[model samples]
Target: MNIVVIDYGSGNLRSAAKAFAHAADEAGMAAEVLVSADPARILAADRLVLPGQGAFADCRAGLDGADGLAEALTEAVTTRGTPFFGICVGMQLLATSGFEHRVTPGLDWIGGRVEALAPSDPALKIPHMGWNALDFEPGRHPVLAGVEPGAHVYFVHSYAMTVDDPAHLLATADYGGRVTAIVGRDNLIGTQFHPEKSQAVGQRLIAGFLRWRP
Candidate 1:
């Protein structure tokens, strides 16, 4: 199998690539993990991973900046229904729009808006950094396969998603209130937390993605 991690000049492409490579090995799947910006390779991918960090508008600009890269991704994931994974700001990009520095349009794959996280506690931080437990339905999604609810996953972000529909929400994490951790439907899956940075729980998630048929 071929897994393509999009290089939009945003995320830690090498780290993500390494994580997937290791996951594939453990899963007993002979898969090739590629970190690339080439649109041609993207279109030919069996699975797609979009990882982003930094500002929403800036990441979007980087993806759009690459010739035919954005369009190729849309076709591969949105049209072809190839199993798609989005990490951090990459997950935020799946929304209809995000208001980080300015109002920016997203891929709109999940129909949501990325907004600043509002923790109920006054002392809580904005960036919601560090490890947090997940709250999810048992046996609800393929990506959460062996990962139990309350499992610790790494997170570091200021903004979170408010999905248009509850059916698309896979899991959430509590900081002071509900923070969307994982969101997906059909062939798409995303995490606000960095699975690469999230140790064992993260590895399980990566392995789940590798074995995921849809």
Candidate 2:
């Protein structure tokens, strides 16, 4: 199977690529993990991963900047229904819109809005950095397979996705309040935290994604 990590010039591409490679190796899955913006390669992918960093507007712009890349991705993921994964700002881009830096439009794959994290406790800091425990919903998504509740994942974001439908929320974390950690529907999955940086939990998540059928 061919897995493509969409490089839109905004993410920690090397680390993500390494993690996927490691996961595929450990799982003994015959998969080739590639990092590219080439439309043909993206269209030929069996699975697609979109990883992003920096601001919403900047990431969106970088994704759109590539020639026919966005269209190719839409065709691969939306039309063909290839399994999709989004990480960090990549996950935020799945929302309908993001309120970071003057409200930018996103891929709108998931029905949600990305807004600044408003912690109930004033002592909690913004960006929500460091590791946090995940409170995953029971038996809803395959991506959480073998992943236990209270599993710690690394997060570093100032904003979080507020999903329109409760069913779309796969996992959450406590950051002075309930923070969206994971979201998934059908073949699409997203993580607000960096699974690559979450140690064993992150590696397991990567393996799960690699083996996930949908």
Candidate 3:
């Protein structure tokens, strides 16, 4: 299987690539990991992983600036039903639009909007960095097969997603309030946390993603 990690110059792609490779190995799936921005490669991919950091608008710009990359992603995931995984800002891109610096449009895979996190508690910092426990129903989604509820996942972001439909929310993390931690609808899934940085739990999630047929 060809696992293409969409690379539109968003942060370091190597770690995410390595994690996916290791996950594929652990899952016993024969997969070729490629970090690229080529639309042809995207069309040929068995699965797609999008990783991003920094501002939501900037990430959107990077993806849009790429020649046919955005269109290719839309076709592969929306039209062809390719399994997709988005991380961090990549996950935010799944929203309808983001209000980071300005109202920037997103991939709209999930009907929602991305906005800054305003923790009700005064103690919680802006960037909810480090690890947090995931509140999810076990075995509800294939990509979260072996992951138990309350598994700690690493997160480093200030913006959070608001899903229009509650059904799309697979999991959440309490940061002064309930923050969208995991979301999915059909063949698409995303994580606001950095699974690559979540250690054992993260690897398990990634491996599950590799084995996921959806």
Best by lDDT: 3
Q: What is the C-alpha lDDT of each candidate?
A: 0.93, 0.90, 0.94
| Candidate 1 lDDT over residue span 72-159, tens digit each | 9998887888899999999999999999979999999999999888899989988899999999989989878979999999999999
RMSD, each candidate, Å?
Answer: 0.7, 0.8, 0.7
In model 3, pairs of residues that clash are none
Model 3 lDDT per residue over 50-149, tens place = 9999999999999999999999999999999999999999999999999998999998889999999999999999899988999988777888888999
lDDT comparing candidate 2 with the true structure = 0.90
TM-score of 2: 0.98
Evaluated against the true structure, the overall lDDT of model 1 is: 0.93
Name the regions of candidate 2 deviating beyond 4 angstroms: none
Clashing pairs in 1: none
User: In model 1, what is the error at residue 27, expressed in angstroms?
Assistant: 1.2
lDDT of 1 at 182: 96
In candidate 1, how many Å is residue 84 off?
0.4
